[model samples]
Target: MRLHRGGRLRWPTIGLAAVVGIGVLWHGRAAPALPTAEVKTGELVDFVELRGEVKAVKSVTLNAPSSTDGDLQIISILKNGTGVKTGENVVQLDTVKLQRTREQQQSDLKRAEAEIEGAQAQARLQEEQNRTELMQARYDVERARLDVQKQEILSAIEAGKTKLRLATAEQRAREAEQKLRSGRAAAAADIESKKQKRAKALFEVQRAQRGIESMTLKAPVDGMVTILPNWRGRFFGANAPEFKEGDRVWPGAPLVELPDLSAVRVAARVDEAERGQLSLGQTAVVRVDAVPDKEFTGTVSDISALAKIDFSTWPPPKNFDLALRVAQSDPRLRPGMSATARVAIDRVPGALLIPVAASFQKGGRTVSYVLRGARFEERTIEIARRNREQIAVARGLRAGEKVALRDPTEEASRR
Candidate 1:
């Protein structure tokens, strides 16, 4: 609209004219002579920065199996920190001695069985011989008894001889009966002894066979394999040696581990000062050092109730260990990878905020120098809350307004 002769500019119109006169300052402003920050409303997230490492949620451990052959010598083993799949061979123990023992035991078992069979046959033969001898002794006793009966018709001297022969035959019969009873029991005992030996040999053979079968160890889950430290290794020093080929381990000792990689977590340590800022179920973004291309989103799965002190430094700083359960577990994530986490402790949505440095107490009121057309106007502001870096403003500020970081009057005075 064009101005007419009768038109007059009011106070409000004058104010609008002055603002437009400043080169349309509302759309954009010229470079400020001093540092400044904008008053804007946005979502604010308080984060606790944590430095830690990536690890699996759970791990599968494989220990050296108990060996019956008295040998735990590892013939082959996967290297430490090697990735593996389920059912993959992890360690192969030396089975040569076990195989030899098994073969020897098996041979012994067969020999014992053969000996039992032979002894049983011998017992049966002895039993048959005993029965035949007993029958012959009874027949001899009966013949002698008949001779005694004929003594009544013989002469005196010949009758006495017949009677003596009958007595001798009776004594021999008793001896034969005793021998038959003793021999039968002895044969049965001998057979039983041989059978017991066979049973023992069979048990040994079974145990050796089991030991031979358990020689090769395989991965139980898909993960990274970390060889357990050999405390008795040849190179015993500050650092323990990792299990490898030709290493002799004790029976039932823990030898290797397969960490589960499907569900991964970040183990983080936070300073005690930041402990209160984190809680379970808070969201986090973790970046692994090895996998720099990915940022895995996760939730705070666990928080330590106790604190761990760092003794390497003076007046040790107490820290708490917490775990973050990753929502998207990339296959590339591995245990012990250095990870950094940004845990959102708290979130404020749609809050009007300004830099903490923008406002200061002046004349008993918190005030900031807000940008006016070609000038700075110091205005009193109401602050609802504040964090280390930002202050949430409850009043006296609007979005898109620039506030001076430092007093422009002070800058002019310094100049």
Candidate 2:
């Protein structure tokens, strides 16, 4: 059926050659290569990796002094990272208002004292006047009695007059005695009331003085001062400012943090999936993101029982706060530094493990592809456990067995 070339009848031969070339082209296409891994027996470490921040194991938070009067205004604060000594002044609130209050209280106290003095003087003057009147009354009574005795020698009318005069004198003397007693009682009561007022004024003055002292916060322990975030009724975000002069801080608001540099730790949040994998006293390898070159060893010390949710977002993610005590302290490890912790939960001294990619789920069973004579054969394997990088095989696979990392059937389909 081919066209003839040159001489003779060559059509049949040309047709045969064309058929052979097509056969060769069909047989020469390359087969796709399948990537594989060899199962190995080695130490398998099951660890939970967490991203966290460096923190002080021991930290003292300095909160703004509790004030009955509104938010306290910061007047002076030690700069962040400043090393401080014990009892050193670290923060100071605006004492202008407190000082004014103290002054007023003192003035009130002075007034109270003056009132007390006036009350005492008035009492003394009353006592003297009462005494003089009482004496005059007694003298009059005695004169009246002497006149009455002389009346016995006079006429009956004179006697009667003298008797009336004596009776009036005696009545006047009794009235004077009553007035003196009443005056003393009134004076004592007045003086006591003034004393009570003075005591109250003194209390107010003392309270004001204590408030002034509270305005100046002193460092309880010696350490570097780190200013805390000023919430200021705003959402926490990157670039939040710290407490500074002129900032109004609410009562009990954290103004500064003095971190004990000698003791350090890492605080990390664990995902719900890894919650059961972490336990107290678990060893971990910690690496600071800022100081990557330096690695620290730590032990899990604490874990929150309740999950923390950020309500600001819808469908918030649950995070559990956990702390790991650093085995050794480093000068470069500072609070707020981002870090990563690889907590070793379970360890197998020797186990047959393979890359997770080497296994696939088939018929609800773990299966691997084993190469046999240039063909991949699907082999069912029992998986004991799986980690991030590898899976531990319990049965159906042996150490040193070569298996396809990816399904070879996919390669065949592509080819």
Residue 95, model 2, lDDT: 82
**Residue by residue across 164-243, what tens digits does model 1's lDDT show?**
88888888788888988899889888888998999999999988887776777888778778777787764422446688
Give the TM-score of each candidate: 0.62, 0.76
CA error at residue 43 for candidate 2, angstroms: 2.5
- What tens digits encode model 2's per-residue C-alpha lDDT throughout 244-312? 899988888888989998989998888788898889999999999888788899999999999998544
Q: What is the lDDT of residue 348 in candidate 1?
A: 84
CA RMSD (A), model 1:
9.8
Residue pairs that clash (backbone atoms under 3 angstroms), model 2: none
Candidate 2 residue runs with Cα over 4 Å from true position: 1-41, 233-240, 311-314, 352-385, 390-415
Instruction: In angstroms, give how far residue 23 of model 1 lies from its true place.
Output: 22
